[model samples]
Target: MDENTAFPGASDESKAEYILSNVAEVVERILTFVPTKSLLKMTCVCKLWRNCARRVLRVQQNMTWVSASGPSNCDGHALCPKLADEVENIYILPKTVLVMVDSETFNGQDCCYKQKKARKSHHGPDSIEELNGLFPKGCDIMGVATPGIVLTPTGSHSGAPKEFQEGEAGYAIMFPRMEGVDIRPFHFCKNTISEANLVEAGLVNNTDLRVVLLFGYDAFKPGAARFLNQVLEPLARSKVLIAGGHVENVFSPKRKCCDRGSYGVVGLTLSGPKIQGASVLLEQDVSSAKAAEAIIQRLKAANLPERNTLGFMFACVGRGHNYYNNQRNVEADTFRKVFPNIPLFGFFGNGEIGCDRIVKEDYNLCDMDSDGLQHGYTTVMTLVHLG
Candidate 1:
């Protein structure tokens, strides 16, 4: 028999231990260049390899989006084929609620006819009128952030719950600083009626929140923003810069007021110690590999307090694998580098949510959907430092 093949009666536990020992060495040797997909396949080569892979995949600490949709077809497709066959706790968004609008809907001339007509029919001026009137007069009138309508010059659309303005030229999508929506599913009550409430509640019991990362499935409802802003305002005031997701122009006014806000769909806030002497990498500035390297160097460079652990979460858009094979793949690559031993989990989303504050050129509140809008090509990832 070959030296590689094991005897027929070898136990799974023994095989796993053997594989884990070798895998650990491999991780130590090629930790920098190892690809997660390749790592998964290597596990299938033997019973021992399978065991080591499971241990590596098991999440010890994690941050996940509150709401997300699973792959449209996970049984056969490869959205996350490596982990596809092994993951059991995957969270998927309900199929009925998310909808996709063609680019024509936003650019065609007749696209907003129905919306404009509805406004004319209203006797006391429609909600859109009321919201638009709120904007500073002669302000070039970009977009509106409201609860039921998101009107842009290109097109005016109505969902149901709320809307956030998409700034001028539609160059950016922004989440305005406003109160959370009054939707039932997201209603905030003392009994923990909403996801935010649950997060807040969880925070109370565990006081180890040094670096907090908030992953949004979509923009913050006006009400939700109010709560988050108020809660996090203190942190920002204390020099804890809130970042992630893209809303540069909207946040320009307050740029000097905090750390930085230049990412596109996710917000990452590291503690002061975590940021000490560590170089910064805006999401747009680097690929997953470099991002991972930045994270590892930062963590290793800083001498964090006891019990500190890094956590990450991401809200993926329904977009296809065009950007770079797949958004999740990019995410996984970063994970392998920064916190190889840490736990991680998340799901694809309809809309990404980030910080509660609104930037100048970000999407207005008008575009938010009652059921939440789904953009095909967007992703939001969050990383938290847990102690």
Candidate 2:
């Protein structure tokens, strides 16, 4: 059997399909063997191979981290003053789960690692090789063979490996996990861009992308406008017009006129070229009801197509009652007002991703920007269309 020769009794299309399928299978195995950045380069072997392999490398799900604290023991008091003081400022549980650790805990070190190692070594042979085998086949997340370490992002003590290297390749891999919730954590280093680099790495192309999800950090600073614009400007100016193209996708919730004291206010800002003719209701000092009402009215006024558009929502984890006493208060209600009956699911993201192309605007060399950095008490929501 010659390496260049086609299989007997097979047409060109069948032979090509066989080659492409073999490449995909090989790529799947290679995900465990190499880093994501390297895997994308293999796509150049062939067109069909690149397209299918790309999907295997991209982050398919959104992840969220929730923080909570439990009662701690003190020598004399029912509540530990140390934990009480910490909760007083944050007003949420500092510990997401019950941690059995020594009283002598260090500030920089996660004492849990010691306990985890002890448990693993005494039972199963615990190593990165063993951990990687635990990943279910065909499930996304690179299926890389490594000891999985989940981390908490907004904790006094963040949890993640200080450094981890892949087998023999010596390339460092950063695995980010959300400790408190079910949402899958998609870890990305500071532009190290291994498996998570979507754009330049060519993992998931814009043509395959049906929706662009966005999530902001804690507080929305005026300065973040630049970062938000960076992602939005490019999409607005894309040759491949977005599904809603800005106009059809915008929505506004109905406002409640009655007094709901101290209730958090949610305002929708559907700006840039994404919303074709849609106008945002930028009303300040208004009650939650008024703001929501204005949004709905404006959504109808935009005169866009009404389709079955919804599958996911993007909001900050801190914005919803995860930080307050009210559940599904502002975020859940806002989506209901606009879409009425579409399913809404999203996570509170540390940062958001959208196109930097701003429609109807002239620009050159659209470089990536992180100007949308924010922290504390803000919710940026987006309605996703799950094809």
Clashes of each: 57, 31
Q: So what's the TM-score on candidate 1?
A: 0.29
- As a TM-score, model 2 comes out at 0.32
Write down the lDDT that model 2 would get. Answer: 0.29
Question: What number of backbone clashes does candidate 1 have, counting pairs of residues 3 or more apart or in separate chains?
Answer: 57
lDDT of 2 by residue, 70-113 (tens): 22242211112332232333311111111111111101111111
Query: How close is every model to the real structure, measured as TM-score?
Result: 0.29, 0.32
User: In lDDT terms, how accurate is model 1?
Assistant: 0.28
Off by over 4 Å in 1: 1-228, 238-282, 303-310, 315-321, 325-328, 348-387
Query: How does residue 36 of candidate 1 score in lDDT?
Result: 38
